[model samples]
Target: MTMTDNPPAVADGFVVRRSIDIAAGIDRVWAAVTQPDLIAQWFGDRCRLDSLEVGAGGAFGWDDAGDFPFRIEEFDPPRAIAYRWSNAVAGALDPLQVVDAHSTLFRFTLEERPGGTRLTVVETGFESHERPDAVVEDHRQGWTSELDELVALVEGAA
Candidate 1:
């Protein structure tokens, strides 16, 4: 797996964008991202989703990190999934009570390549947080490591 930081010129400085090519088809990669079971294998230790449709809500957490509430903003099967969540107050408050000021938007896009899938993840809105630089840097590292894990899981299965 190869990850690159490609923040769009139009985006605010707080954005963290990464793209990687995985040795798997779009369907397999999409399932790994949207399904609770497969998402847990790479994203978090566990995940719970109310629904997979746009406007649906859910929670995802790890043993070390408490759950965070998330609302789906966009859902396009095998292609894209966008959600809003409060990572600014991650383990400090009840995620269910998160407001727009405390949340960031995360988007995942998948494009079918000749031999595999190109997966891109972009997280924005860190400027709303108290510590934008820290938050953005933290997520940049987090995404890099997490995406590497995702690549390993999907490619290993292939």
Candidate 2:
């Protein structure tokens, strides 16, 4: 199939998106998110969630960086959590810094399917006039690795 024939319309650089049906209930998945220790184990290298309240905020980052610059844009408990994130490395090929707005959206949605929970992650709005392709691919690779890490941690393999 030609590029046009593909229905999903993959973006130019990298349309990096993936979802997995985790063999755990929504509650388990929710626990993995709201709990700071569990989140650090699964998703973040290190994380701090302020309040679980809908309007409350949180911060997270990899090992070296203490916390990523972000606030909870939306919080719906076990259903969904949408937050803003930024890497802030100007002119260094860092994808997360593409947006001049100082933040990009990272949304996680959980659905209860027949066997387990369907987890969906979306990190978008990385189109910058400076470095579009590099930014897109960087986040794509990062998210891919992140999802893999999440699966491993949830399945007790990591």
Per-model C-alpha lDDT, please?
A: 0.82, 0.63
Scored by Cα lDDT, where does model 1 land? Answer: 0.82
The numbered model that scores best in lDDT is 1
TM-score of each candidate? Answer: 0.89, 0.75
Off by over 4 Å in 2: 1-16, 64-66, 90-100
Q: What would the per-residue lDDT of candidate 2 be over residues 1-158, giving only the tens digit for each residue?
A: 11111112124443445566676678887777677788888666877777776555556667654456556777787899877666555333343222336556767889998866877777665653357577676777666666666666665521
Q: What is the C-alpha RMSD of each candidate to the true structure, in Å?
A: 3.4, 7.3
Q: Give stretches of model 1 more than 4 Å off.
A: 1-12
Best by TM-score: 1
The residue pairs in collision within model 2 are 60-68
